[model samples]
Target: MFVTDNFHSLKQKILFFILLSPLLLSAQAFRSYSNEFLTIGVDAAGLGMSKSVVATTNDVNSIYWNPAGLVGIEDYQGSLMHASYFAGIANYNHASFAMPIDKESAVGVSIIRFGVDDILNTTELIDSDGNIDYNRIQLFSSVDYAFNFAYARNLIFKDVKFGVNAKIVRRIIGDFASSYGFGFDAGIQFERNSWKFGLMARDITTTFNSWAINEDEFNKIKDAIPGENQDLPETTEITKPKLQLGVAKSWRIGRMFNLLSEANANMRFTKTNDIFSSDVVSIDPAMGFQLDYDELVFLRAGVGNFQYITEFDNSKSLSMQPNFGVGFKYNGIKIDYALTNIGSVGNALYSNIFSITIDYSFFRP
Candidate 1:
């Protein structure tokens, strides 16, 4: 009983700081490398495929995963993925390619884009029957882009590798505003025979400062409004700083069968502008598995904690446990699928994310 009480108390203290840190940091505001959305933070290739790091093969997406995964690879690889977010209301797409310039060096290019679609613009905030509100009016639709360039090399030490990513990012919110920022990612991987250990630091300097739009800047909007005093949105920019650590391993159990296990944790920090008063953090831990029934079929199942997190005790449940997926491969073609949910406290259908991604790659000498 005493232990339970102390645990609960500690949880409250952490939650209070997280909710208050945003105000504390700026006394004021922040999103991560890609956006506030973690679903699209890393490339879609890994999202619909597997979060397994230790056993993952060399691929262009490694720029966001664990770049050290490229250590033993000697190939030119690329993959394209499309995730239909929120039942096709929004589209998430990614493309990436990597080339081994030589045995000791590799370079890669990666891009992630999300299109927000079909938003209706109107004066009413809700749907109207006789005089009821419909929904909020959206003045414009926008898409976000995060471009990545990476370089990885085998370290002088045995079975160790390192890499870095330079990110180019931007976000357009309606026609009224947009923001720009840049960030970097670093990673290291260690491998000894079949088992590997990996770690990644994402969005080290990721931040977006909203641009001030004066009358002289946006002439079109100024001309239309004439003398109307239009109030702009918040003055502080929203930033998401990535702080994540993950470890994964695989055991080649038997011929035609492999059993793999993975565990990962990520905490996103939301800091206030120029205040440096600490920040908001969300910590998530996940455990999962992969099974290879044959050379042509693969299956995966994972469960993680978004609810029982230490600092997120009072938070809403964005992801429920038990996320399961499957995949198939033939020749050089591959297909994959996974299911994830984003439900508010009691709403079951709030967010149903079904993703399907394909990959076509052949070993290159």
Candidate 2:
């Protein structure tokens, strides 16, 4: 039988810590959002569930979702994903690899990039000779990249695992400016009976980005307008820590079906449109479920990003983002697809995501 008493006690402790998070972080909370590209997420499975897989992720994608789950990797695995946003105006890509080092330890690495390519640079449309020159126009790209290194180890306690990540961030906007940043993340996962719990702390030490602007390039735009782009931009950016808590449960039906459901609370110490917001913190909660037949064919759904919108009439309305997905897995190869709405219901911006993963241990000597 399951030990309900122990479960309750642990639950209470987790709740207490969650409640105290705001007080401990509010003093250092930042007013602006930084490194937003990292928040877009990787892998179709997680996005299909509105990124509610913190406690259940077990594949190479765990390196991005919750590193603690990397302990679930039993074989060398590789994953890749590609998606386009804003009607194909931007591209997002991710690649990752994970392997078990021993019975109790695992390691992973991941790379992500988001870019908008072939952007027309019209600043030099009119040459110094005061003549319109289409040939002077150039095409450039704005891109953001992140490299993650993760490690996980099982604890002495039966089913508990912990992990940490060191990440390097890079951003480039043509030749005008660039930035480099570093950050860390930590996560923990544990299970009791059929219940799973996970906690992920991102940017635990506050990510810092330092920028460099090329003065020669800056001079071109500095004179584009009389009073605009005159002063140098800010050179430093800071990203405050954020927390995510997750709970999951599983059930078996008949002989060929199984169901897994999860809920997550994403917390940031800032006032925003999230469902639960205060001056000290804001909480955005999400729920998702997956159903599979014989562990092969799967279906998933989720709803999240709950926000209160103020209308032009000074009235408020509730809005949320919804997502759906399907998957098939066989012989260690998995393919997943998700149809997600990236914006509010009223805006209705939709995107299609596809991801694939494979176990490559068979290729090893």
Candidate 3:
């Protein structure tokens, strides 16, 4: 009787977990509608500086962060970055190339890919002999990719620049579902002496994701999992617009050291029915500092994504993410490394990123 009772308790727990899984998944899906992989900072330098690059970027990697900074690139530049995220469970990769079209204009192209590999597919249904079948299990992967083409030009004013990015996005889940999206971004920057300011409008026209699902394939797998049979959606997901504003100041310390500080605010506006919340607006702020030695070594640190949570009607708490990085430069090549702390969303996770860049200038006779 005790054994039978224990079995019943175990079954109850299993059923409860199965029932709760969908709710958790639904929340994640809703968040991803507008907060996809592209929003994640790419290069190690940007991530290392806690994504405070809006006003301090001046390389090919700026194609992903703030395109207006492309005007600061005086030569042809190329960058590549790779991140081992979530303790090897996933990978993020980015590459970009930028070149000057004239004294007043520059153009760049970049690509990003984030994905997980070799995820096992399992079913709850038992085999004929009442034993689990391991040999018949399948494996799959999920991936997200984005391609961006960007252009930047100095306005009639020498210290002001304007830029735009046109991008295509794709998401795929094994062989069951896929989504395609297109979006554009615009930005402006103003610089004078050691001070710089920037403004970026993300998804200025709003981004729309159209999903194409293989219902038959999904249903087959769903039938094997208890309480998992649900119809797939045949609709579109739209992402609203957001604005980013930033300012930075730089100072030369002595003859061999330089100090730079930056602050940024991201403002998100959404309707009552949007995925974020009923609140019409929200703001997230970040700040960082960089110390450079003789233009060869750099140290960076920052904090961002402050959140306030209330529990039990009496408990209130705050959370913040911290990041740090180091880099080295020689000749025209630069290498950077960064570590980012991601709070306990899915296990206590941290991301490590590495990136390299090369620059070359053509001399005009």
Q: For candidate 1, lDDT tens digit of each residue in 32-97?
A: 323544344343224433354533545666866766665444566666666665667777777777
| Candidate 1 wrongly placed segments (more than 4 Å) | 1-34, 38-45, 48-57, 122-139, 212-230, 234-240, 269-282, 308-319, 342-365
- After best superposition, candidate 2 residue 57: deviation in angstroms? 1.0
Better of 2 and 3 by TM-score: 2
* Model 1 TM-score relative to the real fold: 0.69
**Candidate 2 to truth, TM:** 0.89
Which is the better candidate, 2 or 3, if ranked by lDDT? Answer: 2
- Better candidate by lDDT, 1 or 2: 2
Task: Estimate the TM-score for candidate 3.
Answer: 0.84
Residue 78, candidate 1: how far off, in angstroms?
Answer: 1.8
RMSD of each: 11.8, 14.7, 4.9
- For each of the candidates, give the backbone clash count: 11, 0, 0
Q: Which stretches of candidate 2 lie over 4 Å from their true place?
A: 1-31, 342-348, 361-365
By lDDT rank, best first, the candidates go 2, 3, 1
Model 2: colliding residue pairs: none
